[model samples]
Target: MRILLALLYVSLVGAPGGSSLPANDSFRNTIQSILNIGQITLFHIKKLRTKLPAAPQMEFSTPSIDGLTSISRDLQILDNELQNPVTDLLSQIQADVSSMEGRVRLFALTMGCPVQARPRGHPWASLFPDSHFYLILEKVQRYLDTIFLNKDKLKVC
Candidate 1:
């Protein structure tokens, strides 16, 4: 399950589109991709929840699952908002992203996984072909951090 989620994170947010669109257009496109990836992550998290046994090892089973479900529902609302083109939604979208980041981090800590905290404000131009990849890259890094930190914890569970 960790491998699957990692692969999904990499594929969904790994590559940045290098189109020569205007700055405004590129920002919008990147935001759209971020939103789409957010939805995908929520769905996969749901699937992961289903696979967890009714009786679990970890102490965080109830609250963690509840939090994930709540986030999934919130993402659905954000999805509806995304259908209409608007920059005003960016703040809300970013807030949702932040919430997911914290939840994922807590999930990792609960699972006892080691998280890889990437240095903040790293240059995307070196890792990605496009500079506009920051949003998704940040998401990917956060997810990766959670996974890297908690793999051992998962084994114990």
Candidate 2:
């Protein structure tokens, strides 16, 4: 009876074809590792934003304004690539980056913050008491817009 019980235990513990249980555990561990990496990346991004020098007002120019137009065009191209019937990972990453670039450009423009440079710190942050954090909030909103808009474009590769 003890021998029969031991055999049963081995069969239940082992994978089909006699693959080691450790191998399956390793696979699960790897998946968890990847998830942990993603979480760390997000945390690092938040930390970096906190450490950034205050955003300055941007100066608009024919060339700078034109850059934004070019950026928008790039976004359209990325979007088109993502919408292709045969979708892949690289196309998705490009779409995400393009979307992010567009939103950042747009937010900077709308906030009356110079895309070039206004001053060392955000003037609007201090001058507009009622809207003290409006510029920063706008930037965050733009980031969210980019992320949600291009989420489907994310590529594992």
Candidate 3:
């Protein structure tokens, strides 16, 4: 998305030789922002769910990357209900996540990290239909944070 491209532009063109910060610091900041966006969206989802109890849950198909395309569609359905901040926040999140995910893939390839299996759908999605989106975001944030902060945890790869 544009957010990811813009950030990449800044990091690549706005800095001398493509970067001012060390790689770890740069990645840490990206991960933090991604988590922050997800946190805000989760907060909004919780607020709406508290009032409406039957608020919708977004589902991703098994094999996360393939299912990722559905996210924009799902978020659009909730747009009218969630409105400004939440919508805007959710809007920002996907780009950030995609960017971070790309970095993770690149890092994995560079380091010869093995590809980990994408999580499958089943009990988690079915059991927590109401909170499934929230759970997915939490897992993503944790995965990115762990990998970014601890290279060895690139067990994430």
* RMSD after CA superposition, every candidate: 23.5, 18.1, 13.5
lDDT of 2 by residue, 1-157 (tens): 9999999988887656566577667645643442343344345445544755555563322211123334334334333333333323233333444445455445435434445321232122244532323233333334334434443322111
**lDDT, candidate 3, 89-150, per-residue tens:** 34444454544445444445544664444333222223443364454454444433443344
**Global local distance difference test of model 1:** 0.40
Q: Which ten residues in a row have the lowest lDDT in candidate 3?
A: 63-72
The candidate that achieves the highest lDDT relative to the unseen native structure: 3
What TM-score does prediction 2 earn?
0.26
Candidate number of the best TM-score: 3
TM values, all candidates: 0.26, 0.26, 0.32
Which runs of model 3 end up more than 4 angstroms from their true locations? Answer: 1-89, 114-130, 154-157
Error of 2 at 96 (Å): 18
Off by over 4 Å in 1: 1-89, 122-157
Give each model's whole-structure lDDT. Answer: 0.40, 0.41, 0.43
Q: What is the per-residue lDDT of model 1 for residues 48-128, given as tens digits with 9 covering 90 to 100?
A: 446543422222111122233333333333233323232332344445455544554444445455554522442223342
